[model samples]
Target: MVASRSQVADVAANAFRRSCLMARISTKEELRRIIAEPRPATRVKILDSLDEQSIEFLKRCPFALVGTTSADGTVEVSPKGDEPGFIRVEDPKTLLIPERVGNNLAFGLNNILDTGEIGIIALVPATGETLRISGTAEIHDDPELVASLSSLGKPALLATRVRIKHCYFHCARSIVRAKLWDPKAWPAPGRISFGKIIAPRIGESEAVAAQIDANVEGAYTTRLWQNT
Candidate 1:
C-alpha cells in the first residue's frame, strides 16, 4: 500500500525530530567536555577596535560575508564582493559596506534594520586567514557616502555602517584543511538551477523554468551594476 502525502510528511518530520534529539549538548559543561578549550592568546587576541594590521587587512579585502539575524530568529549570511577597498574604513571603529545590486530579497538588510546587530568575515583571495568582526550596524542612505561606494560608475542604493565592538583574526585551520586557495585541489564546478527549485513551489511549467534560467544567466552580465 502507498502512503498518503500527509502520512509521508509526518514520517519525515518524526525522523527529523529523532535526529535532532539524539546526542544533543544542552549546556556549556556538556559542550566543553568534548571540545578542547581555546589557548590563552586566543582569548586576548580579540580587539575592541581595528588596529593597524587589521586596517591594512581591510584595504586589500575584496570579499566579505555579512551575517545578520531578524527578530524572528532567522539568520542570513550574504556574500558581498567588489574591487579591493569596496568597503571603506570610515574610522578605526566604523566600516562602510556598499550595497550592490542582486536578488531583491533584502533578507540581510531587513535583519540589520530589525536587530542592529551584525557580523562580518572579511576575506582576501589566495589567502587562508579571515578577519572576523562583530558589532552593531545601521543602514544609511547618505548621498555622498553612497556615491563614493559606486562601482562600474553606478552608485550604491545604500550602505551598512558597522560600529566595531569585537574584531579579531580567525585562524586559517579550516581554510588550510580545505585547501581553499589551491586550484589543484578544487573539485569540478556544480551548477544551480533556480528554475528547477522554484517551479513546483510556484506552480509553473518547465518552459517558465527555462525562461528563469535564461534570465538569471542574462542578469549575470547585464545586472551586475544596474537593475535589469
Candidate 2:
C-alpha cells in the first residue's frame, strides 16, 4: 500500500534528523585530524603588524566587520563602512575606527569594554582577497581623535583603537567561491520584517510587528542619515 502524506512526512523528517546527526564532526581533535595544516605560503601570510602591502589593501577597503565578545562570552559582530581609506593606519601596529552613529544598541562597543578582544575582517569590493586583524581594543573618546576622523561635517563621537596582535592576508578562495562581487549571480533583494522576528519576545506578538515596521519606515525616511 502507498504511504499516506503524514507517514511520508514522518519518514522524511526522521531521515533528515539522522543525516544531521551523522554529519556533525563532534570535536576539535576530530576536526584537526581530518583537515591538513596550512601550506607554507599560507602560513607565511600571517604577520604581526600592518605591512606596506597590507596597509595598501586596507587603504583601498571601504568596509569591514568588527567581531567582539563580552566578558560573559556573548559574541557580537558589527559592520563598519565609509569612503575608501576611512580606517586610519595610525602606526604600523595600530588601527583606528571612527565610531559613527548607528542603531545605538552599542553591542560591539560594549563587548570591547567588557573583554578588550576584537577581530576584524576587512574587504574591498571587486577584490576577492580580504584582510583579517586580531587585536586588543580600547575605546577612545578624545576630541582630537574623534575630530580627525570626521565624515560629512560631523565628528565621530568616539574612536576605537585596535593594537594588533596578529594580522593576515586571507586568500581569495572563500570570496571566489561565494561570487560576492558578481552582480549576475546575486538574488533579487526582498523586504525584511525584522519586527516580526522580535515581536514574540517582548509582549503581545500581534501589534508589535506593525508598530515596529512603521517606526522603521519613519526612521529610514527622516532620521537615518541625520548623524552621518
Q: Please give, for residues 1-228, the per-residue lDDT of candidate 2 as tens digits.
A: 999999999999999999999989998877888897768987887899999999999889899999999999999999999879888999989999998877889999999999999999999999998999999999999999999998878888899999999999888899889999999989999778868877977864668898888877777777655542
Clashes of 2: 0
lDDT (C-alpha) at residue 110 in model 2: 94
RMSD of each: 4.3, 4.0
133: Cα error in model 2, Å: 0.4
lDDT of 1 by residue, 70-135 (tens): 999999999999999888999999999999888889999999999998999999988788999999
Q: For each candidate in the order shown, give its overall lDDT on alpha carbons.
A: 0.92, 0.90
In model 2, which runs have C-alpha deviations exceeding 4 angstroms?
Answer: 1-29, 198-211, 226-228
Worst 10 residues of 2 by lDDT: 219-228
Worst 10 residues of 1 by lDDT: 219-228
Predicted structure 2: lDDT = 0.90
Model 2: how far is 81 from its true place, Å? 1.6
